[model samples]
Target: MKLLLVVSNYPYEGHPYSGAFNERSALALRRLGHEVEVLAPRPYVPRGLSRLASRWSSYASIPEHETRAEIAVYRPAYAQLPLLGGALWSESCAYAVSAGEIARRHRRAPYDAILSFGLIGAGGIGWRLGRRLAVPAAGWATGNDVRVAPRSSFGKAVRRSLEKIDLVFYQSAELRACGAALLNVAPDEMDARRHAVLPRGVEEPPVLSSERRHELRRAVGLGEEQVVVLYLGRIAAPKGVFELAQAMARARERCPELICWMVGAKRGFDDSAKLARCGSVRLIDACAHEQIWDYFAAADIFAFPSHGEGMPNSLLEAMSTGLPAVAYAIPPIEEIDQGSGALLRVAPGDVHGLADALVSLARTPERRAALGRNGRARVYAAFLSADRMASAARRVAQLIETRGVSFSQFADRSAAAVRR
Candidate 1:
């Protein structure tokens, strides 16, 4: 099957971590023996330009082509300020325009189906294109789109887009329900039969030698015998960075040798500096995705006290590296289960509970190691192996080919029945 995968974000030189999960899914689909072409609208901001000139130059600047994991990828230019309002509008318009061009070019050899990620921005484009081309369209809903955006006008527009798509993929049951609710559609209308829980995947990281681990510890000013807790990803409020800091401080008082290393970028360094005053926390600027494995391998544990998520890729990466995770027991986090790692009941802003969990993990190395091994096993069985996802994609493709129904058609039929 020939598939056109559309998304607003893609891995680029400056933002390699961006849209990696989408890229991984595309790779898995290709590995399933399907031909895949990624249609991405590369966003650009020209510096000190004649505004119109800047937009034109930025659009022209995008590479016409690229390859990722043996799949052909094309990036068309889109002029959008990265600000919230303009970005959303720009993405919708750019995708609609670019997708039409793609349809025209491939008119003689039309794509078998279209798969899109995100609802408000990317879904509008896919729905318009699929309607134009008379092909099946599927949309994947990320956590923020469902949980955070629904209260806004843009979010309502996204719900309309979802209503027009054939299938909505979610990472968890809660998210699926949220999507259905936002659309004001019955849960059954958003049937799990068509929907799927497709969590992200990660490659196993390289095994670090004891010497390498010790070297990393020394470089970070952590003692060889200390229990090092590592936090990898953005250091934002939603990420529970402040809570993690408090937890580290508490853990330090109990186990003086416990060290916390935060390896990620921060919008502000002031918070990190405040945490450093506790004398047990250190913050390093973000590391390359390729280099993240070493930090996981070197650390005794991975701690993320984030409040909400849609199956975070970082958790999977940590598990793949046999690093035990201590995270807040949010809906997506519960997917890890007891067999995978420790899930603590820390409310979104519960600093004390977060700190206590860290201390407990630090004191119990044997339990931590066991948890890490279990997490690795769980990841291999359920998340890391892309075979199940490939099977699901193939099944969806087969349905699209056999039914010959556009997503909007299915949605309209379903909605009509509901009204009747």
Candidate 2:
């Protein structure tokens, strides 16, 4: 099946981590024997060559179009105001840019369905593009779209876009419910069947052998005797980094061998100093995209105290690497971490509870091994494997094909029902 994926934020020149999850999904779909193209909009700042111009010159220089990972990707320029609801504005510009590409692609072969990520911006763009092309559009909801948007500046606009889309894909059950509340359409209009509850996939990372693990540890000057705990995402508030630090500070009293290898950064900012006071925590600088797997391999356990998440991709990666995790028993986190017995989850903000859990896990290496194995098995059996995600995508394509040239009938009736 041929697809046109529209996203507002995607990995571009000099930005390695941006929209990486979306890019991986695209590649996974292609691996399943489908053709995919990307339409990612870049922020444009028009100025009289001022300081902003000097700062954003790299964005303008980003290649307008490039084909990477065996997929054709296009980055169109969209003028945006950062602070105040730029997402809505980006969609309008994206629609204009996407229409031309859709037309060009349609001439070669019509896409089975249009796929868009990020419900706030790209969802509207995909809905508009689908309307123009008279095809079904599926919006993938993640992070800010479900969590931040409803409470943000453009709540109603986001809701309207969700209402208009033919289908919605949510990475977690929490997000699915959050979307319904945010969209707030009547039962008759918000058809649950139209939403696909598909968590993002875990592409098998480079398998780290026991020898490789030792090599990575030695390279980082970590002694073979120490227990390395890893926090994969941003080192910021809400991620509970400070709380994790406190937890470590307490846990170290019980097991002084515990050393946290803080990897990744907050928007590429290394506030490693935040955890400086924690004697047991080691502030490792953010690694390159390719170097992440080595950190996972080098670590003995994954500790994520994040208060919230949209499926926790980093957690998934760590789990797939066969590392036992200790995180919060929060929604979505609990959804993934529960029942498997692979994770030890404490209450959301209980530092002592978190510390106790970590110390217990650290002391019991046999239990850790058992949990790690179970976590890896869970990822392979139920979570997002490449084939699982591809299969979900294929099902959506099949649905669109059977639904015929347009999903306008469904959209119209739902809108009317919502109105009445």
Candidate 3:
């Protein structure tokens, strides 16, 4: 089938780490023998007054372009001025304009289906464009859309759009619950038959021999005997970086040989000073996505004390590489089960509990090794393989073909049925 994949945040040459999950899904679709195209709305600041507003805020402009990846890509330009107390009126306007462009293009070459990522402006834009082109459109929701946006007016608009899409692809049960709550629909009315839990898959990394592992360790300045706990991703607050630092500090008191290597860029949250103060923690600025496997192989264990997430790709990648994980036992994470790794009950701000878990894991090498092996086995059997995700996508597409109505229409009907 011919498909159009839409998203605002896609990885370009300039930003290779951006929107990796969506890229993985699109690649998976292509592997399943479907012709796919990408439409990314490039957000930019407007000229003059809008540029000033963007300098102050960053919602004043949008840009557009086209590229070829594993599939054809289109990046439409639009204005996104942040005004009226940080509203996204420019984003809405950009979507309307881009949707018109997409419609015009589709008239020349029609697509069988439209798949969108994000629940806010991007999903809404995809829905509008699909309607104009008379094609089935599905939206994939991650953590921010469900967990972060609900507190804002933009979130309300996104919720309405969620109720209007053809299908909803949620990565976790928590996200599904958030959608149901936002739409004021019953939990059961969320339509699990149409909605699917499809986490992105990780490619099999090159097998790292013991020599390669040791070489990588030396290159990264980690000693052979040190028990390295690795954290790979953006160093942000919701990621629990500060909590991980506090945990490492406590663990160091017990296991002096333990080392924590944080390999990611600093973006959302600031914890550099806190981590620096800890003698055992080492922060590596950021590595290429392709080079992530080396870090995973060099580490003894993976530590992700995240407070919020939607099936973090980092954890899956670590597990695929046979690294044991010690993470906060949140809902999306709870899906990891106990066999793969140790899931500790560390609430968002519970630094003490996080510290204790790290300390416990640091002292038990046998437990760590066992968990690591189990995690690898679990990833291979359940999550890392792309076949399951492709099957789920196919099922969602088939549901749209059979139902004759969009996912949002079905959700609305389901909501009404619940009320009756």
Candidate 4:
């Protein structure tokens, strides 16, 4: 089947770390013998505006089109309004731009279905484009689209999109429940039939021998006795970056050999001042996605104290590299844990608990080794297996072939039947 993925964030030349999972999904679908293409709308800002903000300049620099990882990615320019943060107006502009490009492609060789990576921008764009092109469309909710966006000013818009989308794929069951709640439907209702829980998978990393790990640690300026705790993601409050920093500071007092390495883009949230003050905490800027595995190999523990998540790719990647994780006991993380002891869990915002967990893992080498092995096994069995992506692709193909009406339309018909 031929499919078009409408995504707001996609890895580009300059921002290779952005949307790494989306890239992986597209590649996986292609490997399953499906023709997949990506349409990611790049924000367009005038040169004058670009001069004012380096962010805008970076956006302006993205080429109109590029083939990333051997997959065709079309990036059309969409005007970005200042302070709008890609809200309704930005989405409208993106839709207008993407619809035209997709229409041309559809005329040449029609796509089977359109899939959006998230709801706010890409989902709406995909639904609208699918309607205009007479194709089925589905939405994949990755965290914020369900939990955060619905409570913001985009609530009604999101509900409307949720109703109109043919199917909704959530990264976790908890996120699926959140999406159902947004639509005001019970778990066993029409929402259940129209939605699925499909977690993203991580590619297996090269096996790191003890010698290789020790070499990597030495390359990164780590002593043989030092313990490394790694965090890779955006440096933001919601990601618990500040909390991780504070926890590291507290943990170091107990385990003097402990070192914390926070590697990610600051984006808008700058925790440099806070992280700088914390001794033994190293803030490394985000690097290429391919280079991330080395950091995981050199680290003994992965710390992700995020406040919320929809199946984090970093956590999966870390675990895939045989790194035991320490994260908050949020619903998504708990779902991943499933009492498997694959990761050590702490209460959300419990800096002391987080610190203690880190210290305990640092002090107990045998427990760390056991948890790392368990984490790697869990990741492979649950997420890295080929069956996961193949099943997802088969479901998408089924949706394309069988699902024609939107979820809301089906719900309305069911309601009328009950009334009759």
Give the TM-scores of the predictions, in the order they appear. Answer: 0.84, 0.89, 0.86, 0.91
Q: Identify the runs in model 2 with alpha carbons over 4 angstroms from their true place.
A: 47-58, 149-153, 185-190, 266-280, 408-420
Quality of model 3 by C-alpha lDDT: 0.71
> What is the per-residue lDDT of model 4 for residues 118-175, given as tens digits with 9 covering 90 to 100?
8878888888877777667888888888875566656666777788887788899888
**1-420: candidate 1 lDDT, tens digit per residue:** 888888867665545666776777777777768888888876655454425453334344457688876877787776555444633654465764486467664575768778887765777777766666667777777677676466675667677677777777776667787877887787778666566666545554567677887777688677767888889887776888777888787778888877888888633432555554555567887766778877986798888888888777787788777788878888777776743343334566777777777778788888787877787788777776375566557666766866544355555543343233
lDDT of 2 by residue, 368-404 (tens): 8998998888777767658666767776776687665
Candidate with top lDDT is: 4
Higher-TM-score candidate of 1 and 4? 4
TM-score of 4: 0.91
Estimate the TM-score for candidate 2.
Answer: 0.89
> Each candidate's lDDT (Cα)?
0.71, 0.76, 0.71, 0.81
Error of 4 at 382 (Å): 1.3
Can you write out model 3's per-residue Cα lDDT over 296-371, one digit (the tens) per residue?
Answer: 8788878888888887778888887777777777787778664344333456567777777677777787877787
Q: Identify the superior model by lDDT, candidate 1 or candidate 4.
A: 4
- Residue 324 displacement in candidate 1 (angstroms): 1.1
Candidate 3 structure, TM-score to reference: 0.86
Which has the higher lDDT value, candidate number 1 or candidate number 2? Answer: 2
The residue pairs in collision within model 4 are none
